[model samples]
Target: MERIVLPGDVVWEREVFASGTWVKDGITYAKVPGMLRDEKFIPLEMAYRPKVGDNVVGIVVDERNAGYMVDLNLPYNGVIPTRKVRISLRLGGMVYGKIAFVDEVGNVDIGEVDKLPAGKLITVPASKVPRIIGKKSSMLNQIRDISGSSVFVGNNGYIWIGQKGNMQLVMKALDLIIRRAHTTGLTDQVAKYLDENR
Candidate 1:
């Protein structure tokens, strides 16, 4: 059973894991209402916040004299300076890059980037990205091997499926993974789904 805690509720009197909690005068309180599981507070609602070193898939939406504005599938757009890019990208082009910095005001800066070929892009809840990749990338590898497609999963929840084999199947499998992410025994469930659909 999980324990539900409200905002400002004391989670621990001393030090604990820093996620989802704030410290005040040596006592840690819940920053958000959430379920306490495994000594971690799992918030009922969570949104993706860009962090440095996270790889992301972005679409070039607008070009500026100094850089390109990229849609990172997040609330804030990321800017990739022209000097940092090796290949020239046009509007609507896709690129894979790492977030280099996020300012205090939430503006994002993208680092070195590689332009990607035309492909289908899908968006899933950012929190479910780990489940899609699975342990040691087991789930992602399985999808690639079975579908014969190059799949790029961005930490920001944007997934790019290269145009290769069984695009529809790969999309379906990804959707299943996203939908069943919270359920236990999900890997087995995905395998069964693939078998039945293939």
Candidate 2:
């Protein structure tokens, strides 16, 4: 017989399964082929639900109300208030936050997490932040202009870049800028090279 599950249960094979499947505390669930039941449930409690105003990590699944709809890894989706965020967020924006409110209608609100000493979100540690800004912000500017992405560098070396529609190139450029920042006049050299090569 297939096992059963309740809400607030996490999927054991998180990387290999779909979201929103039912789970019970301390139990795992799997969909099995043609049996009395399709769900193979196991006891697992790793998945938990977020209470009202509790912070959590979520991905921006949809944008609305000048904010965003985030799948809080819970049974319900949460709203990250635009006011709670200081930047323009697009689909798939990764955010860490606390729950701000859970309305009677099942809508949840999320408040953005604080910026760490590195000046960007806490996810970017201070030690590696400098690599993104480059010396004197030159490489940073190049990334903004070339990728049409808005780049911000915090005084403490935290870097924030905003872009839409597949930002792999922008990400690569930012990484390169930060990694090569220490080279003498690397920004200027790149500028001159781009001018001549193009």
Candidate 3:
């Protein structure tokens, strides 16, 4: 049966919670509002949680002798050590990398850092990132192909587009995907929309 679930609502009886959900007292609870269909829970909205090996988009917020502090759209900021980056870090510059470590309280250490060129930045609900990328990044590639704009999506919901001209169209496509993430054939729909609109 499909039903609406709110935060803290019991979604399952298990020790370990799913990626976007949480566990309390040996029971799983929905961390965000969404639908529970059959035995699966679909989160409609979710915040970014730092995890090792996740690729993220961040903005350089502060510089340090060791490295720099990056705002990763998380409650706690992330850091990139000097050795991982080649360019001179500047305040407000965009960076991309894989999270190398996450401390006990959500602090993250990012690795393989690379500077991203000037682009328009957009944010979406973190839970919708998977839908935006689609299977094997087919949706992302299609958007790029149709719009002819460079695009990068982070697990944290920050998106970078190489150009601003087509970003409006891209955002529209993203909105559709986010709203219909649970639906089938969304990739095909997005592809058609982008091709026709672009």
Candidate lDDT values, in order: 0.85, 0.50, 0.85
**Candidate 2 lDDT, 1-198, residue by residue in tens:** 343444543445343333334344535444321111344333222234345654354566897767777765456677767775665665766565666677776577776554222112222323334445556765666756666655554322224545442245555554544455434466676566444433
Q: lDDT tens string, model 3, 28-107?
A: 88878877888878777776677799989999999988889999889878988887665587799999899999988998
Candidate 3 similarity to native, TM-score:
0.85
Could you tell me which residue pairs clash in candidate 1? none
Q: For each candidate, what TM-score against the reference?
A: 0.85, 0.33, 0.85
Judged by whole-model lDDT over C-alpha atoms, candidate 2 comes out at: 0.50
lDDT of 2 at 4: 41
Off by over 4 Å in 1: 1-13, 24-29, 32-36, 40-44
> Tens digit of lDDT per residue, candidate 1, span 96-181?
99999899887898987988999999888887888889899999888888888899999899999999888898899998987766
Q: Is candidate 1 or candidate 2 better by lDDT?
A: 1
